[model samples]
Target: MLKSSLNKGLIEAGCDEAGRGCLAGSVYAAAVILPEDYRNDDLNDSKQLTPHRRYELRKIIERDAVAWAVGVVTHEEIDKINILNASILAMHRALDGLKVRPEAIIVDGNRFKPYNFIPYTTVVKGDGKFMSIAAASILAKTYRDDYMDRLAEEYPQYDWISNKGYPTKKHRQAIAEHGITPYHRKTFRLL
Candidate 1:
């Protein structure tokens, strides 16, 4: 079962990003604030769940979250700032869209560039440990996957539908065959 919040004493938004390690497409992030007592045994790390389960959990999170938002850093921006900074920027953008300003933030990774004066804690693999983070992970993953699937329609050579912009063998082969697209991260080494 997933714990509802990292700190029950304060309003907190859980933050996480998806597609940070991808060779193409944008990095997506999500911030989700759940009630103090929310629980779901089906909740886990988004990567650990199937596409069907992630979609189901995403709907639940969207319906039940006190406030939630998603952000994206485009491929050009990712290449300009590097994936790490782009990930952090995406998180900041997500937080900017929250309906309720949180007292604190619980970030899924071990590093964050602090959002304004609001306090934050970075827990490695937090999605497995906290419900809010898990919810954020599901949102980010599903949203990013959906975006990539749409992009796949325009660039079928990348096979984004299957790889989801990850560095897969077939994706690399496609890069070698067709060359990079406008969506591919320029700074990333395709080989």
Candidate 2:
């Protein structure tokens, strides 16, 4: 049972990013402000849920949340600033898109750069512990996966539709065989 919010009195947004560890494609982040009463038994960390479940929850979150938006940092940006900074930048971009301002932000990971004078708390694995964070995780992961699936059509050699840009054995093998595509993060260990 994920907690609805970290602070009861304030409007809080949960933040999380996906594809930070991937070898290719952009990192995606989501900031979600769920209603205080929102609850769903199936909602959890995106990683723990199947693709079907994540997609299902994405629909639910989008429909039910007070405000939800996604942000994306491209592979070129990741190569320029490095993954950690890119991930944070993505989160900031997500927060920038929020229609409603949040009094507080609770992030999934331990490190997050502050946004817009808003107070933020970084909780290790907050996505699994907080409902809003879990909703954000689902949004980020599903959106990134959808992006990678489209990229896979253009660059079938990487098999991104299946691996979703993660450095799987087959993905590495494809990099070795066909060389890196424009989508591959050059700073990453592609081989």
Candidate 3:
């Protein structure tokens, strides 16, 4: 079972991002603030869950969370600032949209730029250890996957509907055959 919150008696938001390693589409981030007593045995890191499970958990998180929001940074932005900074910026944007201010933040990864002086703790694989971070991971992964599915309609040659813009062998092969699309990150090595 995952812990409810990193600190007691304080509103805490868990932050996580998805698609940072994808060769196409935007990166997405989510900030989720769950009630201190929130519990779900099925909740875990987004990558650990199947698509159906993640979607189901996303609905539960959205309905039960104190506040939850998703933020996105386009491929263009990623090329400009680099994926690391873009991922942090996306998290900040998600935090900006929260209805309730968080007293502290627990992030799934080791790196994060400070958000308006809010104290944050970075945990390697924190999503699997904290309920709130797991919830955020579900939101970010589902949202980014949805975006890529939509983009796949316009560029089916890349097979984004199946690969979801990850740098899969077939995705790279498509890039070689079809060349880059407007959605492909220019800074990323496409070959």
TM per candidate = 0.98, 0.99, 0.99
Residues 84-186, candidate 1: write the lDDT tens digits: 9999999999999999999999999888997889999999999999989999999999999999999999999888999999999999999999999889999
lDDT of each: 0.93, 0.95, 0.94
Per-model C-alpha RMSD: 0.7, 0.6, 0.6
lDDT of 3 at 40: 85
lDDT of 2 at 72: 99
Residue lDDT tens for model 3, 1-191 = 99999888899999999999999989999999999888888889998999999999899999999999999999999999999999999999999999999999999989998889989999999999999999999999999999999999999989999999999999999999999999999999888
Candidate 2: the clashing residue pairs are none
Clashing pairs in 1: none
Clashing pairs in 3: none
How does candidate 1 score on lDDT? 0.93
Q: 81-168, model 2: which lDDT tens digit per residue?
A: 9999999999999999999999999999899987999999999999999999999999999999999999999999888989999999
Better of 1 and 2 by lDDT: 2
Worst 10 residues of 3 by lDDT: 34-43
